[model samples]
Target: MHIEVSGLYKKFGDFQAVTDVNFEIEKGQLIGLLGPSGGGKTSILRMLAGLESVDKGDIVFHGKRVNDLPPQERGIGFVFQNYALFKHMTVEGNIAFGLEVKKWSKAKIKDRVAELVELTGLSGFEKRYPHQLSGGQRQRVAFARALAPEPQLLLLDEPFAAIDAKIRHELRSWLRDMIDRLGITSIFVTHDQDEAIEVADQIMIINKGRLEQKGTPWEIYKNPQSPFVAEFIGESTIVEDASSLRGFGNASDWPGTKALIRPEYVEVGKPSDFKLLSATESGRVRHVHFRGSEWLVEVEVGSTRLVTYRSLEKEIVHPGDEVQVLIHRAYLFNNNDSWIMENKLKEDPMPVHI
Candidate 1:
């Protein structure tokens, strides 16, 4: 009851979106595959689900290689982001469609359809068409249809993006619980960081077709292996002075493996004499965006812009007021720009240009 993918590669002409990706999922584990739009998250999922062919790779399930198996023969469930329901069919018809295609007995199909509708909370809406249901209901129908087939692995491709915000949250929770109860191994692909963090048991982040970092949500967020993964996963603003930090190494090409830190984690009001260029700059507030409980304050320290999230209770700075910014920390990168940790948390956050 496990799934393994090794050395997956996909290229459209010269674009190698997924390169040498390898990972395995145990039975009943929910894996969150996260990355930017072009990072090849979908490509990897498609390859596993037999939707997209791979240039080279091995996909195995339960100790048997299944890379060449077609979607139906592989016994995998696939739910697309777009719902993809037949507009002419009722909710009951949609769920029963897959079972019917498999040539299951009519009585068995009826029983399974009833059970799925109940599990997905689509009981009352079974008579309704896709157009008549809310976005969440439609998504539930999609889930029921996929589950009715009883797949070895479920592949979800951003299933909740089209739903409204409130419903998206509820559906994510519901879907996670439902999948867990079923004890089914699943791979969820999403471009939204928050959604990935909220739903996935284990997150695998990829950048430009390469595995950047894979771990628990808290682990990857606190310790990113690449600047692209860090910035892609949260509200990140790169401060230029990170180049000279002790372990940051000599700056040659790419931004020294980014000193990745979230805006909320930054500490303000440190003394200006910290000896870092960012600490010494007297910058004026440029713009401020209210983010409910916190304010996303944008400050210009000379030519570079640093974004910080401050508690709302503090007096908001005006556009012209000069403010001191202290960059207490950063990290080092190899010549190729892969992120590496340098300073410890207790260490200074103020930037020290080596």
Candidate 2:
């Protein structure tokens, strides 16, 4: 609990895995380490769990330096992506393994195992072997085993990666509620943006072995500090020479050269029903895709392709049909900084500054 990582660095031979990554986690908070593969998410997590030696810097748990602490001594409960269950052991035996290793009395281990079984919703399945259980059930067993020792911090490396899409979606809420009820400070590593946003109390975006940004999911999405985050967080289309877009400011007035448009910020409709008609741009429909709940329409405005959702309530438009596209807002970003650019027609009509 109350974990702080400072000047953290890790390398493997010639490759730098994590570079000067720093962040803090308050007690009882759930943090998501989100990034692309090989972006140092797992490396930083391994270091926090004391499984990897820190090439530089300090890891403090509750103000005590844990840099030299061994993995067993760090009081961390780890759940791997594969579940890592014992094929030969039953659910009860697997859950009790850590307690058994700690040399707890037989009666105490039995009671503890029973409690964990019920808590993880595996009460009646305790007698089943790993292969006998479903993927989700096996993962519950893994979580139960890790939590048996009552560790101070819980670390999950892509806990739901092995589960199928439907179960993974269901388990996201289940795991989140369970962790909240247990009040254990937890960190989970995930490359899936939707999973991180849906589950974590806060998210740390890692990129190319660096800590790119850290904030609540809404903050990271609505206000990206860098170009990578803007492109990485959502379904965004990058527009070059954004100043050419109607109602957007001149290129020379803003520091950023490019604008990022999110699907939600775009509206596509017939010229008759659209709002802010003056700010609307003429675009030709390029493609349309069904997305279960709604249609994903691709509209081409000049050289840039803009994507937006077509509500089921609206009349369907075929490819090659001309339509009016209204962009409510866009994120303008360059190498060093980013800015939120509201459509001038939707704003106070002042000259655009950024």
- Model 1 lDDT on a 0 to 1 scale: 0.78
Which prediction has the highest lDDT against the true structure?
2
Instruction: Report, for every candidate in turn, its global Cα lDDT versus the true structure.
Output: 0.78, 0.91
Q: How many clashes in each candidate?
A: 9, 0
Task: State every prediction's TM-score relative to the real structure.
Answer: 0.85, 0.96
lDDT (Cα, tens digit) per residue for candidate 1, span 1-354: 598878888898988878999888888889998888888988888888888887998888988998788887988888988989989999999999989999999999999999999999887888999999988888889889999989878989989889888888999999889988998999989888899999999999977888778898998877776666667777866655465433233433465344554665444433443444433435677888888888888877666667788777776766767776655445334446555443342344864789
**Number of the top TM-score candidate:** 2
lDDT of 2 at 327: 88
Across 193-299, the per-residue lDDT of candidate 2 in tens digits comes to: 99999999999999999999999999999888888888999998998877877778665476558888999999988889764578888999999999999999999
lDDT of 2 at 274: 65
Model 1 lowest lDDT segment of ten? 244-253
